[model samples]
Target: MVNLSVATFGGGCFWCIEAVVQHLKGIEALKSGFSGGFIKNPPYREVCTGRTGHAEVIQVSFNPDIISYHDLILIFMTSHDPTTLNRQGGDKGTQYRSIILYHDDTQKEIAEQVFEEVTSLYEDPLVTELKPFEVFYNAEEDHQNYFNNNQDTPYCEIVIDPKIQKLKKMYADKLA
Candidate 1:
């Protein structure tokens, strides 16, 4: 039997992160969601207001034997601008903040090490939040697999395409 581990993080828009990570191998399942919030079962509208205290996140289940959690963490750290505080590109608000919600102590430790390693990559101090995994509220059905289904959309082409290209260039070996 294959054992799957979960990783949850918010690097910007859940759509961007989901589009990039879905290309990687060993990813059993993925869901665009919100986490690190104050309220329970927060809807997309509420979270988007940034008053809910949640960030847009993606929850991933993968086989570590094929793709290590360390690599996942590294990909997340590099794929988005973790150096920016509560923003990615034109998207602004606390809901757009970069964050990593670790599922356990091991994931947290790996994230810390990865953060240290990636610290030199940026000129600014890394602002990616590292917190224990609490709850993930799945985003609306329309938001799931957004890039794949809405490739023709301008946002997908402009914002998400570059991320996918970078993932291809940087983690070509990790792609499925």
Candidate 2:
């Protein structure tokens, strides 16, 4: 069996990130969750208030042999705007901040390098925080697979559909 690696990212709403990344090849599983927070087991309502210090993140499990972590990070950076601080589109506050939670020293180093490389592509500095992986509170059941379940919703059509299209166009070779 192939060994799977985990990468956690908070680029915006977990729904949007989860929807896009789950389509990539080698991704074994994806969970919508809250992380980098101070509270224990923060619920969606608390997280939405932005007081829990938790960012809506998705923990992605993937096989490195098929899709390297570097590739995943590149796709993530492109899928969302990393230059915006604590925000993605209409989502605002700390709960929607752009962040990458590394699982180890190697991941940290790689994340730093990737951030630097991606930074030069934009006129504004990249604000995506590179932090150590901490507790991940699984978002409530209603939040999981949100995009797939609510694709017809107005929010999904306006905010998430474009992201999916962009992913397909940019990483056609990486799709599962």
Candidate 3:
């Protein structure tokens, strides 16, 4: 049996992060979802209202032996602008906020350490929240693997494509 480590993160639109992280090695599973909220099983619409307190998140199950948590944290930090609070790019509000909902103590420590290391290199402190994992409500069927299915959509072309391209160039050696 293959051992896997799970890390859930909310950074703008899940499709952007999913498309890039999916290209990484050691990633066993990546599901777009919602978490870090007051409500349970929050619907996409509800989360978008920013009242249910949910953030769009991706629960990534990866193999630690193949890709270390430090590497994963770096990917998470670089993929989105952690300096922005409750937003990323054109996506605004809490649903699009940056958050790292860690699964356990080790993940928490790695996340904090990575944040510190990353902040030291940049002028802006990481605004990504380090929250405890409570529940992950899978996004609507249409939101799953969105870029793969809706590549021609305006959002995909204008937003996701550029992000994916940047990730490929930045993490070329780590791509699957």
Candidate lDDT (C-alpha), each: 0.95, 0.93, 0.88
Model 3: per-residue Cα lDDT over 56-173, one tens digit each: 9899999998888899889879878999998888889998999999888998999999987889766777789998998899999988888999999998899889878888888887
Q: How many steric clashes does model 2 contain?
A: 0
Reference-based TM-score, model 1: 0.99
Query: Compared with the true structure, what per-residue lDDT tens digits does model 2 show for residues 1-176?
Result: 78999999989899999999999999999999999989999889999999999999999999999999999999999899999999999999999999999999999888887887788789999999888998888998999999999999999999999999999998999998
lDDT of 2 at 65: 96
Write candidate 1's Cα lDDT for 1-176 as tens digits.
Answer: 99899999998899999999999999999999999989999999999899999999999999999999999999989999999999999999999999999989999999999999999999999999999988999999999999999999999999999999999999999999
Return the TM-score for candidate 3, rounded to 2 decimals: 0.95
State residue 155's C-alpha deviation in candidate 2, in Å: 0.7
TM-scores for the candidates: 0.99, 0.98, 0.95
Badly placed stretches (over 4 Å) of model 2 are none
Q: Which of the numbered candidates is closest to the native, going by highest TM-score?
A: 1
Query: What lDDT does candidate 3 reach at residue 38?
Result: 90
> Which candidate order results from sorting by TM-score in descending order?
1, 2, 3
- Pairs of residues at least 3 apart in sequence or in different chains that clash in candidate 3: none
Pick the lDDT winner: 1
Candidate 2 worst ten-residue window by lDDT:
111-120
